[model samples]
Target chain A: EDQVTQSPEALRLQEGESSSLNCSYTVSGLRGLFWYRQDPGKGPEFLFTLYSAGEEKEKERLKATLTKKESFLHITAPKPEDSATYLCAVQDSSSSNTGKLIFGQGTTLQVKP
Target chain B: DAGITQSPRHKVTETGTPVTLRCHQTENHRYMYWYRQDPGHGLRLIHYSYGVKDTDKGEVSDGYSVSRSKTEDFLLTLESATSSQTSVYFCATQPGVAKNIQYFGAGTRLSVL
Candidate 1:
């Protein structure tokens, strides 16, 4: 069975603090890994997609790195605006060309000013 | 913020009642999907449409149905709403150019009493 798990269900960080959120997965064949940021009363916004181990992507203060069994979303000097629920999802090769995603219980981060 | 729009941003209905949520996108994306989000559980796919009149069941499709009669609109229906179906429902669209990237609309919050 393909499953995705995210640790540290909730985290409180001071403004400018750096931390990392983890996403671990067990899939038949890894196709893609995705990261999203969701704010209260709103939908999730796409962050990055990592396709292979050792792949990394960055945007401003956020950086995502992938491994064989897990991925990490590292927030560097996160601001209060960065406070949101971070979601991690995976797509397995077995899912026919339809592009179905299996998501993990998100990690909620609060960057207090 | 994608061009997707989900109608009935909030709804409250009784169990056994029929309910329908509408998703409209201006992006003309070929793929549309419905997902439900809940606490302690990640978003789960309910149904998806690959093209006009082409729809398929997803991991959590039971008790739900979907229709894509035109290129821009997709509708999700609950034949008989149940308390267990109360959730925040999100509609996402995948542009053909970015097969793995899905853009979401502000979710609809549904409550079944």
Candidate 2:
């Protein structure tokens, strides 16, 4: 079975704090990895996609990096508004054509002001 | 934010009753998905559609059913609602093949009493 696990179910940080959330997976033939931010009571918003090992993509305070077995979402100098549940999903080779995604539990981040 | 919308943002019902959640997208994507979110368990896929009338089950597909009869709408129905089915249901859609970015609807908070 393809599985995705995220660490530190919840994290609290002072504003401007820098930290990284982790998503580890066990799947065969990874086609792509994705990062999304979801606010409480709302839908998730797409953030980044990393396709191969050693690949990274950045959007403001967020940077996503991927490897063979894990992916990291690095948030630098985060703000209070950045406090949201970050989700990681994988698109395996077989689901590539259909756009099916397997998602991790998500890291709930709280940036205190 | 990518033109995806879910109806009945909040619903509370009793067990054994049938419930239907709707997801509509204006992005004209070819793929649509239904998922449920729960603490510790993360987001679990319930069902997905590659195209109209082309739907498949996901990891947690039991007790739930889905239908997609048009290009822009997908519906997820719980055949017999249970307390265990109480969850925040989300609908997502993305362009197939060359595109991997998934856009999600605001979600429907369903409480099976």
Query: Which structure among the candidates has the greatest lDDT?
Result: 1
Residue by residue across B1-113, what tens digits does model 1's lDDT show? 66999999999999999999999999989989999999988899999998999999999999999999998999999999999999999999988634769899999999999
Clashes of each: 0, 0
Tens-digit per-residue lDDT, A1-113, candidate 1: 99999989999999999999999999999989999999999999999999999999999999999999999999999999999999999988876478789999999999999
Question: Mind giving the per-residue lDDT tens digits that candidate 2 earns over A76-100?
Answer: 9999999999999998899887888
Q: Which candidate should be chosen as best, given DockQ against the real structure?
A: 2
In model 2, residue pairs whose N, Cα or C atoms come closer than 3 Å (at least 3 residues apart or on different chains), thus clashing, are none
Give the range where candidate 1 chain B is weakest over 10 consecutive residues by summed lDDT. Answer: B94-103
Q: State each model's C-alpha RMSD to the native.
A: 1.1, 1.1
TM-score of chain A of each: 0.98, 0.97
